[model samples]
Target: MDALPFALLLCGVFLFAGAVKGLLGLGLPTVAMGLLGLAMPPVQAAALLLVPSLVTNVWQLLAGPRFGALLARLWPMMLGIVAGTLTGSGIIAGAAARNASVALGIALALYGLVGLLKPQLRVPPSVEPWAGPLVGAVTGLVTGATGVFVIPAVPYLGSLDLDRNDLVQALGLSFTVSTLALAVGLALHGALPLAASGASLLAVLPALLGMWFGGWLRLRVRPETFRRGFFVGLLLLGGDLARRGLA
Candidate 1:
C-alpha cells in the first residue's frame, strides 16, 4: 500500500470505529484492530490505534461524573493491566507478533459469541477483590497479544451491575489505560515509528467526525438492535481473519 492509500483506508476504518464507540460508548479499538489487521501486521495495526483510542476513550472516561468512584473500585485491575502489559510486551513484539492476527481472530470470535449469548453472570462483591485483578491481568495479556481489549473486561464490568452511564465510563477508563499501556509496550519494542504515529494522530480527526455522526444516530436507533448488528459483523470479520491467518 502506498502511504496516501493506507492513510485513506485508516481514515475510513477509524471513522467507522469512532461511530461504533460514539453510539455504544465502546468498541473503537476492537473495531479498528480487527479491520486494520486484515491489511497489515497486527502489531502495526495496534500501534496505529493508540492515538485515536487514547483520545476518544479519555473523552469517554472523563465526560461522566463517576470517575472517582469507578477508579477507586477499579484501581487494582488497572494496576494489573499495566503489569501484564509490561510483562507481555516482549512476546507481543517478538515471536507472538507474527501470530497476533490469528489470536485477534479468536478473540473477536469469542467476544461476538459471548455478546450473542448475553449470559448474566453475577460477581459477588467478596470475589471482586481477587477476581478484578485476575481478570484485568488476563485481559491485559490478551490486549498485549492481539490488540483487542474487551474479552473478560466487558463481561466482568457488566457483572458489577453498574448503571448504563457508569458502565460506559468504566469501559472508557479501562480502554484508556489499555491504550496507554499498549503505546508504552509498542514503544519499548520499537514498533511505533514516526510515520505510523503521525498517521495515527491524523486518524483522530476522522474518528472524531464519525463519533459525532454516530452520537447523532444513537438518538434515533435502538441501541440493542445496533449492538446485535455489530456483533454479527464482528463474527463475520473474525471468521475472515481466521481464514486469512490460516492461509
Candidate 2:
C-alpha cells in the first residue's frame, strides 16, 4: 500500500475502533487489532494500539465514581496480568505472522461467540479471590500473544454483577492495565519502535473523535441492538482472519 493510503486506512480503523469502545465500553483494541492484523504484523498493529488504547481507557476509568473500590477488589488480577505479560512477551514478539494470526483469530472468535451467547455466568464472591488472578493471568498471556485484550477478561467482568456504570468503569480499569502491561512487554521485546509510537500518537485524534460521536449515539440509540451487531462483525472478522492464516 502507498504511504498515504496506508495512513488513511490506519486512521479509519482507529475511528471505527474508537466508536465501538465509546458505544460498548470495550472492543477498541479488539477491533483495531483484528482489522490491522489483516494488513500488518500483529506486533506492529499492537505497537500502534498503545497510545490510543491507553488514552481512551484512562478517560473511561476516571469518568467513573467507583475507582477506589474497584481497584481494591481487582488489584490481584492486575498484578497477575503484569506478571503474565512479562512472562509471555518474548514468545509473541518472536512469533511468525501465521501463529500470531491464528491466535488473534481464535481470541476474537471466542470473544464474539461469548458476547452473543450472553451466558448467565456468575463468579461467586467466594470464588473471586482465586479466580480473578487465574483469569487475569490467562488473559494477559493471550494479550501478549495476539495483541488483543478481550476474552476471559470481558466475560469475567460481566459475571461480577456490577451496575451498568460500574461495569463500564471496571472494563476501563482492566483495559488500562492490560494496555500498560502489553506496552511494557513489547518494549522489553524491542517490538515497540519509535516510529510506530509516533504514528500511534497521531492516530489518537480520529479515535477520540469517533469516541465522541459514538458516545453521542449511545444516548440516542439502543445499545443492546448495537452490541449484537458489533459481536456479529467480530465473529465474521475472526473467521476471515483464521481462514487467511491457515491458507
User: lDDT of all predictions, in order shown?
Assistant: 0.89, 0.90
lDDT of 1 at 228: 97
lDDT of 1 at 71: 99
lDDT by residue (114-183, candidate 2, tens digit) is 9999999988999989999998999899989888887788899989999989998988898999999999
Per-candidate TM-scores read 0.97, 0.97
For model 1, the stretches where C-alpha displacement exceeds 4 angstroms are: none
Stretch of 10 with least lDDT, candidate 1 = 89-98
lDDT of 2: 0.90
Which candidate leads the pack in lDDT?
2
lDDT of 1 by residue, 60-100 (tens): 99999999999999999999888777666666577565577
Clashes of each: 0, 0
